[model samples]
Target: MTFTDDLKKENEDIFQMIFDHPFVQGIGKGELPKEAVEHYIKADFEFLNAFIQVYSLALSKSVNREDMAYFHEQIQFTLYDEVKPHLNFSEYIGVRFEDLQGHPLPPSGDHYIKHMLYHANMGTLAETLGALLPCPWTYLEIGQKLINKYQPTKEHPFYKWMHFYAESGKETEEMRKRLDVLAANSPVDEQNRIKDAFRKSCQLELAFWEMSLTCETWSGELAVIK
Candidate 1:
């Protein structure tokens, strides 16, 4: 099996937990509250903004033309295409995507971005992919699972959201293939770090869904601090 396949096999338990989460289940069933869905739009907007920043930083760090091009493509896709579903969803719900910009992510959302930025700032390109790959992988997996269970049509409330993720993206495929190649070429020690990073990212992806579903935010002094 490929390296990504191995990572998924080992992370299967986390994947199951994510699938079992009420937030994910509700999305699949189209039973989520608009408040919850709106919360997701705002958080994800902030999340992907951070994503573009990471890719921009990565692009700067790339030593080779190929790597630079890869990062550039990722940035473009994220800005223009990856966010399309969010925009579409917001419109369907009468929320302006522009209005959601600059909204602060809940703690877990910030933590997830900080996790990736830590790798992006401190690690090699291959190590950084470990942190980045799971975002797409987990979302694609969630989409596929929901599609299989619900067989959602265009009439589905979240058909666009579900279809967008379920269909995955070129960047997702590129990330997996690039990581596999990097893993094949890297030493054993680096491979372990990659595995650890991938696992942590998967766990964070699960947390993000829960955060969105519950509209979780800081409370008391912590809430006031922001």
Candidate 2:
């Protein structure tokens, strides 16, 4: 199978797992009690804040200039423009990246974000953008699934929160055209470097979600203390 094919398969696997998982299903469909939904949202946001900040710093320190530029653009466009501006739910909780300064990322998190940044700076641009493909693509799939399952209207914060999934410019076919230009100009070695980066980045995302599943399991065994 092609690399993109494998990524789509991986995404399908995760979507199935999350969809079937009782906790996620409950939250997605608004079947979970209000308290449980609030609790899960807190945990999810905590992890995400830690994630984006470390990713930002890691990419900021990347060895390659152009890849670093990609990371910066991702931060500027996706995080600032699409995510932060669109998601009012994030603001209500005050769970921004700044809230997670000095927090230690899981080994999986470190490897995923840093590797992408490193590859972008040093590897091929297809690979650089490829490293980014997982976020928007996976998000797009899940957001569509959720909206199909439960129609979150404009009045609902859930609707606004899911905008990040559909709004990323990278998820468009236009990105492929842009990447094709780089692929033509790039050396063979650089091209392979990008392909490797893209593959590994997808694997990292799979692992991160797996970790979240584990976290959910462990947290569930604990007492619910409000």
Candidate 3:
């Protein structure tokens, strides 16, 4: 079995937790509170900026032209395709882009982005892939499952969101190929590091969902100035 497959099997418990998380179930049921969805979109917007940077770091670290091209393409897609659409959705949901601009990152988002950036900037390519894989891969997995189970209509609140990741889309296929390459070529010594990064990332995915469900924010109260 491939390394990615093995990692998924070993971490099935965490994956199941993420799939069963209230936030995800809410999305599936078309019952997620607007406030919680707003919170999640805002947090995700902040994380995507950092995510783009991680892809850039991967591009810089790429040894071959093909890898560089792929990473660059991913960076573009995250910024233009993913982030832009989410901003539009935010406006649709009554949360302005301005509202998201200065709000502090939720603790879960902060930690997850920091962990991914640390690995993307400082770790080997295989480790970087491990750090990056969970976001898209897990979303795709959840999307497919939700679509199958819910058979949501076009009017469903999260129809577009679920459709975005529902299938083995172009980006998803590209990511799978990248993972296969990494699994085949990465050094034996780095196996443990890769697995650890993947597992921790899956755990963080769960935390992120919980944070959204609870509308978690920074710990201290905000001062009001009039």
Candidate 4:
């Protein structure tokens, strides 16, 4: 099996937790509270902006044109393909998508972005991919599973959301294949770091769902605000 497949194999437990996460279950069931959904969409907008920044950092760090092109394409993918769902959902809730752009990320979202940026700032391209790949990878996995299990239809409240991720599975598979090549070429020490990065990101993925399910926010207050 490929390195990406092995990383996934060792994290089967986390993947299962994410799949069974109540927030995700709620999405599939079309029973998540509207208020929680609103919070999540807004937080997702913040997360996406940070996500693009990390990709930009990765693009800057690329060693060759192929890697550079890959990161560049990923940046565009997040902007267009990923942002569409956020736009559609914001409109559904009567909020301007632009207005959601600068909202404060909830606690888990903040930690998640920080984790991605940490690798992008300090680690090699392999480590960055390890940090970055899981976001889309897990979503693609979840999307495909939901589509297969639920056979979502127009009547489903989040059909568009689920369908978008499911359809994007092809693209996400390409991403994992790319990461696998990169990981296979990296040094042993770097590979270990990459594994840690990948696992932490997987854990964070579950926390993000928990955050959304609870509509998590700043507890007390911040002196200066975003």
Candidate 2's C-alpha runs over 4 A off are 1-27, 31-73, 82-102, 154-157, 169-172, 184-192, 216-226
What number of clashing residue pairs does each candidate have, in the order they appear? 0, 2, 0, 0
Give the winner by lDDT: 1
Q: Candidate 2, TM-score vs. the true structure?
A: 0.59
Worst 10 residues of 2 by lDDT: 216-225
lDDT of 3 by residue, 85-175 (tens): 4754565567676666555678999999999999987798889888888888888889899999899998887778788778536776677
Best by TM-score: 4
User: lDDT by residue for model 2 over 1-226, one digit each (tens)?
Assistant: 4445544565565546544666444425544344333343444444455445544754655678865775566556544555452234434444553442343444455566677666556654466666666556655656667777777677654566555555544544444454566666778776666566656655666666554444333422542423
- Candidate ranking under TM-score, highest first, comes to 4, 1, 3, 2
Off by over 4 Å in 1: 221-226
Task: Report lDDT (Cα) of residue 209, candidate 3.
Answer: 94
Stretches of candidate 3 off by over 4 Å are: 84-92, 222-226
Local accuracy of candidate 1 as per-residue lDDT tens digits, 12-38: 999999989998888788787677777
Tens digit of lDDT per residue, candidate 4, span 38-122?
7888788889889999999989988899888988988899888887777656655667767657778888999999999999999
User: Which is the winner by TM-score between candidate 3 and candidate 4?
Assistant: 4
Question: Where does candidate 2 clash, by residue pair?
Answer: 64-121, 67-120
All candidates: TM-score? 0.92, 0.59, 0.91, 0.92
Estimate candidate 3's alpha-carbon lDDT, on a 0 to 1 scale: 0.82
Q: lDDT at 135 for candidate 1?
A: 87
**In candidate 1, which residue pairs get closer than 3 Å at backbone N, Cα or C atoms, i.e. clash?**
none
